[model samples]
Target: MNTRKALYQFGYRRSPDQDRPTPAHHPVVVVGAGPVGLCTAIDLVQRGVPVILLDDADRIGEGSRGICYAKRTLEILDRLGVAQTCLSKGVTWKVGKVFQREELLYAFDLLPEDGHKMPAFINLQQYYLEHALVERAAQLPDLDIRWRNKATGLKPRNDGARLTVETPEGSYDLDADWVVAADGARSALRSMLGLSFTGEVFEDRFLIADVKMRGDFPTERWFWFDPPFHDGRSALLHKQPDDVWRIDLQLGPDADAKAEQAPERVLPRLRQMLGHDNFALEWVSVYTFQCRRLERFVHGRVVFVGDAAHQVSPFGARGANSGIQDAENLAWKLALVVNDAAPERLMETYEFERSAATDENIGHSTRSTDFIAPRSAQELRFRDAALALARHAPFAKRMVNSGRLSTPSTYETSLSTPDRDAWAGSARLGAPLPDAPMRDREGRPIWLLEALGGQETILYVSNGDPPPCSCRILTIGHDLIDENGFFEQRFDASPGSAYLVRPDQHLAARWRHPDSSMIERATRRLRGFDGGAA
Candidate 1:
């Protein structure tokens, strides 16, 4: 067996059909073995859900280039329990230098020292990320990852869904209880469902070059703004975990695909940016892309994820991270519904929450690009000036950094809701709570992230008598909570105010004392389980 086939069999374990008496179909059919597809499959298989993951590619390549693994993406991988393998070889960028003109204004402390949900950002090539995910998925006894298998006619059936699959071996008929169309922006599945991919295709083309070098570059992101190097368009310089530098050059509007991508043309751009005196070009590709997303991520039993669900400019690195988050959110909910833990309608929330997130992230990445790398000269100058001011001004810096690297855009219509007793005040409404530091019984500062334990919980900080509920109630201070209730000291919040947080680390409601039944109502609407457990 080839390295990939061997690793997959040993890792995710997708067995090839022997005699094939029209083999029985799986419960979940994931079409697209990209990062999103692979991640989703791994989650399902590990959870004991039978799944069949398919990809159009002969191998993981072309269609969706999986590059630039961010910090949030790493955290998601860590949650999968296989991040160490990737981190051991992926690039870690703790420091990044943001530039304006010729001056190096301020370096962004991208990674926080406090315990992270996962390791900081790692720069591993897409190939490696795919290999790792595929390996993990293969190890699952319930997963069947088929290579060189392209899904054709996908139609939902009465009790389940049927598909016309074309494999290198032969054509076959397959059936599944569920189908996920993660085929990407130009998803054949989405088109087959007559679902409209709504959004503007921003006319932008970028040329990406990956080169292996012997010298050492800083373990930080270097962004040059309208520098003398690559003409007017901005140049982003980053180091991959494999000691390869990924350099991007914004192609001009009139640039030709054929003429521009010639090795002669690409090597010159690299030479210009790297001082015309150094650097080597290992791999090059010219990519033309637009920002677009589907109006509805679901159409009956077939669901969409990753670029297939939505496509955004890779400015804030939110595109892939959001995709991974979608995979995680849908995986658990799908498992619950499949096992009858929750109603089938619960799966609808995936559309509600993820669609909302994709919309916001699209706007964020689009807006960041105008500043990160403007299209025109006038726009570039305006962005250059903005960065110059933000570098010196605290407020400006905070605003820019918060929007760029920071998450928590807000989830107003999520299916999961907080208990009314958990509700404290506005602090609990649609936002991530600000963190404060305090020592634990061990005398070391306690991290709120650790308190989360990767699940939904509540933190009630009240001055008056503490109310009762089930989900992780930690009453801080001497109010009615007790001496052990002093957890408020950890986040430096008010002594008597209680805040309700959700499983995804976003706040639900907050109040100083007994106020309203808003939290309880929301919780009921989400899980449908009325009582809170101790």
Candidate 2:
């Protein structure tokens, strides 16, 4: 029987005697089946690491959770070979209008979505995005995805960890070299580790309604932040595929979760926000969200990922994407450690980098709420004036809507690696590999990432010069980067931009063009042969 009876049974019966999926002993155990956990499982299997992924969801994407998929998330999906499928099904919008009742207050467009390195932001239902990830996890031969299996107990062994799981068939114990917890905000495994999630719970309850609606309810996201008509309420409406639209209303501390769920109250609020009278309600949820971060993401044999590690407020769709990035970061590091390419200390950097990221996102999401509904009366008046000012000044539009989105952070400070060297300050330290066009010997355009094959490397920007034999060479420049842009247009010519890029796509080190002796020094750095070398 499915433990959660309300999850639309979908053939999961109440009786214990039923055919259940056989669970096998897996080398790596992932305790959650959300996007983050599934991504981690796929990363492991593709690299030849046998893994088992477990989740309590009867089928994937049933959870009416995360709705926004960012550019970084899409890049990860692209690496997993699911990006095209995702973009095909999802809607892409570049314009957003922030309103105050009837008058448009702030309007802005997302930065060039057809970015060199990534695709525009995508809007797919959380359910749909989850399905793609879970399906990919199901395809890997080295990976096992047990849908109804729930992690009941965790025990650390001498060399690895022992996972005790329960399913309808019965209970069994499995062993693994490592354990990853993507179980979510109320993470059981993290609790078992005695970790504390610390943050503040806001004083308002947010209601979400997914309904089939009529009327051209605006293709772009419409936000009514601190509208003068409503003293202390906020509303947002966004278009989904087909006739589906998501309408949200802010309910303050006085909101009764059960009482406010009534169709009477929900329908009216949705109508008001959507500016449509005819529509069928699909789902309605009234809940308050919290902003919290785990005290520590790593605890010896176990590691926390996604919402399990941090619960950033969902104001701007950072939570799910951040978790996926967490999985990507942790996956390769764990693989390297298990395969013995690097020391165990490398695993510690996972917590160091991702935790910093999660914390920053939490702060951004928190600030975003202030614009949704100002907490102070003075702030409310200030917003009204700011809107008036932005009306006359172009900078106001940019400033007010500056955080309707967020970008992935660059990784500048990592665990000391031998490759650590002086920075050129020309590149973003932890950003993804810059997407510059390249050429084959036959003179065809190829993506730089295509040449690297998503593995570790040093981008030797050769300016018509042959690089020494010690480093991986990518003869780039003269075509991809536009000189007028903020970033340096051409790489250094002498040794060129000799940058060591980690497998995770973060810059490890960069040096000036190489002399023969400098090439030797760069080579030693590439293989972790420096002062910080393990």
**Among all candidates shown, the one with the greatest TM-score:** 2
**Candidate 2, which segments miss by more than 4 Å at Cα?**
1-25, 113-117, 226-232, 398-403, 415-426, 437-445, 469-471, 477-495, 515-534
Candidate 1 matches the true fold with a TM-score of 0.80
Stretches off by above 4 angstroms in model 1 are 1-23, 61-64, 276-278, 372-381, 387-403, 406-409, 414-523, 528-534
Error of 2 at 413 (Å): 1.4
In model 2, the worst 10-residue window by lDDT is 1-10
What tens digits encode model 1's per-residue C-alpha lDDT throughout 285-319? 66654568888887778889989988877655676
Q: What is candidate 2's local distance difference test score?
A: 0.68
- Using all chains and alpha carbons, the TM-scores for the candidates as numbered come to 0.80, 0.86
Cα-based RMSD of candidate 2: 4.7
Candidate 1 — worst ten consecutive residues by lDDT sum? 1-10
